[model samples]
Target: MFLKVIKHKTAWLAVLAACLSACNTGNSNRPTDTPTSGTIHISVDETYEPLIEAELKVFHSLYPNTHIIADYKPEAECFKDLLNDSARLIIATRELNAQENAYFKQIKISPRSMLLAWDALALVTNRENPDSILTMDQVRNIMDGTDKERKWQIVFDNPNSSTVRYIRDSLNKGKPLPPNTMAAKTNPEVVDYVARNKAAIGVIGVNWISDPNDSTSIEFTNKVTVVKVRADYGSEFVKPYQAYIATGSYQLKRGCFFVLREPYRGLGTGFATFLGSYEGQLVIKRFRLFPARINAVFREANIQ
Candidate 1:
């Protein structure tokens, strides 16, 4: 009986030792990155470069110890970075689909995503272009390859950009872009192309030309004419103004989202949180995009 009791106690001691070892190992494996310090890599859709750049500037100033390296590319490549574990966070126009969530689940990493803002695509043309207004039907015709006359040369920032995807999915009904559509390396390039071309209309994020505080954006705005769009043949034309974006009056509106795969409350989480905070939403408002996380009232009044 004495021998059996001793054996049982020894077995219990071994199990307790193993459990303690595992607990210590798990504690050691905790991520080193934190909200106020540590470095992180994030991917952002290039269309949002200006907006994100401004946001990062403020973030870095507030949290001087934290560093975030951002890779600006097409929305598709941003997703690739997140899936391959090269980036801890990604800013894009849409959230992950069912497949993406499942893949994260399989990897034992539950990703989180939040809507940051309501963004719109602006159609900009050369100052010399006489046609500065378009109906949704006309825009659809241009995108679906039905405009045989090819009245305008359609330009996009990139073939794989979120702008292209938005048009294809929302306007073209999943159909591919027209063969004659032109793609520039960046939004600025697209604006330059349109500024120089007589018949080119560049599709770009509203933020690129909407920021009055940004000298580059003002220069681009001066170089091209922002086209006013109407939802239908008989509707009123409207530019992608903040009030219009908030009220869904802008025809090319889409939601901006940040998808994070951070394993802890790291720098990525800090930055993501900032994007939805009051200060961050103020930045978004300054850029003329509609903030999703903040409340703002719009009233109709006639201008003098």
Candidate 2:
């Protein structure tokens, strides 16, 4: 009986030892949470949502463990979110200004801004419209409501949009946008307006007029015809093709930036790296935007 009791005690001790060993080994083997690999809260400008969404889908496929919660807002709203530290990432057409950069530095988070892609500011018109090309000066005259011939009727989204700002800055040359130019609340509304108005020309980001592979792109192309813009008569009235934008033929182009509050070390850093990587740039190319990589492939593609 004494020997049996001793054996029982030995068995219990062995079991405990095994469990303790397992607890220690399991903890050591478990994956650690990376600052950049976990759930990331990001804000995206509405104009870039489709491209971002497509890219995110590809990203998620590769890193299924990572989660991204994205809020789509206008560029101004995105900047506001970044300022408040409400988002770890902001994808927009513009970069931080000096004041905004100083604010980030004050907060002890000097953001790393990456220019991922180039997008064109495209002008659109109805398919039946005879004029398929316009000079910068002609667009300016129309926006200023000085073109008495009414050869170009202007239609666009909200005044706060990048499209409006580009037209106002480029065409108006710092002058106020003319009252005759119509402003719709949304891109779809602008498209609808232009579709119904034969003479009206809609100005929007080139992403809207992307090719038929993507649903949003198809929708825009079906509704309107993208007009070519020329710097002058000798220069080509180049449409916003990916190759054209990449090679600098498309003059009205903007950069898409990813602004992080701090030098991303974890998930933020990882995502930033991904955006600058070949795979991310491939997604950008697929969206018909000019990727920053500027590889030979980008030069060869005819993405119109």
Candidate 3:
């Protein structure tokens, strides 16, 4: 009888030990940070500085406990930070490719990504420059240095910026930039260059000059004239307005993607969720960019 009692107690102790072991394993896999709290580092493509700054400002106001440290740099640098594990989240123009997916799989992390907004590249020139309308063919010619007239000088925010990559991959068809293509350090520098040089045309993100509520953006618009673009010679020229961007009238449109490498439900995931949420989408809409995550309705209006 005593032997039977000893065996039963041993079984009970074993079961208890197994339960504790499982609990420990689960706790180890749990995330250290919660959605509404904790500090995190993130990298954002410099093209999105104004839009993201507005987002972070509102996020901080809503969740006082959470803090996000953002580093705005060229798009290539943003990806490097993600690959090196220096940033938990990154705002980029594109999502991960096959190689990037394999790298994350090897690290035992399944990265998450979502489309946040539809962005556009603005072709800006000096206010005094009369050539403000361009067709897709003419723009291509200017970029490839085939425009025999060479009427305008081309400038980009940075050599490694997504704007340069977009022009090369999408418009230039994987061709190298022309020898005369200039590189400014930042988007603001591109604007400044165009503002000062009557013959210079700057390629920059639309968000820089699209924010009506932002004083800096308003000032930028006043400094340089945004060129209207048509898909072809006969199509109507359209600006990168939200309505036009939504309807595919704008010719140089791209997507804004938010990628997170977090292994658990951390602050990075929280911020990514917020970017797709209705409130966040509203913020993106206010900046004049088309929000991709939400359904937006537009109506035509006439004024007397």
Tell me how candidate 3 scores on lDDT.
0.91
List ranges where model 2 is wrong by over 4 Å: 1-36, 151-153, 298-304
Ranking by TM-score: 3, 1, 2
lDDT of 1 by residue, 1-304 (tens): 9999999999999999999999999999887779888888899999999999999999999999988998999999999999999998999999999999899989899999999999999999999988888888888988888976556788999989999999999999998887779899899999999999998989999999988888999999999999998865336899999988887767789999999988888889999999999999999999999999999888889999
| Per-residue alpha-carbon lDDT of candidate 2 for residues 175-265, written as tens digits (9 for 90 to 100) | 8877667778677778889888898888777776675587767877887888887764438888888878877777778888888864436
The residue pairs in collision within model 2 are 35-267, 36-266, 36-267, 36-268, 37-267
For residue 101, model 1's alpha carbon misses the true position, in angstroms, by 1.4
My TM-score estimates for the predictions, one after another, are: 0.89, 0.81, 0.89
Using alpha carbons, what is the TM-score of model 3? 0.89
lDDT of 2 at 17: 100
Q: What are the runs in model 3 whose C-alpha is more than 4 Å off?
A: 1-32
Per-residue lDDT over 1-304 for candidate 3, one digit per residue giving the tens place of the 0 to 100 score: 9999999999999999999999999899677678889898899999999999999998989999999999999999998999999998999999998999999889888888889999999999999998899888989999988888656789998989999999999999988878888998999999999999999999999889988889999999999999998875346998889988887788789999998888788899888999999988998999889999899999889998
Residue 47 Cα positional deviation in candidate 1, in Å, after optimal superposition: 0.5
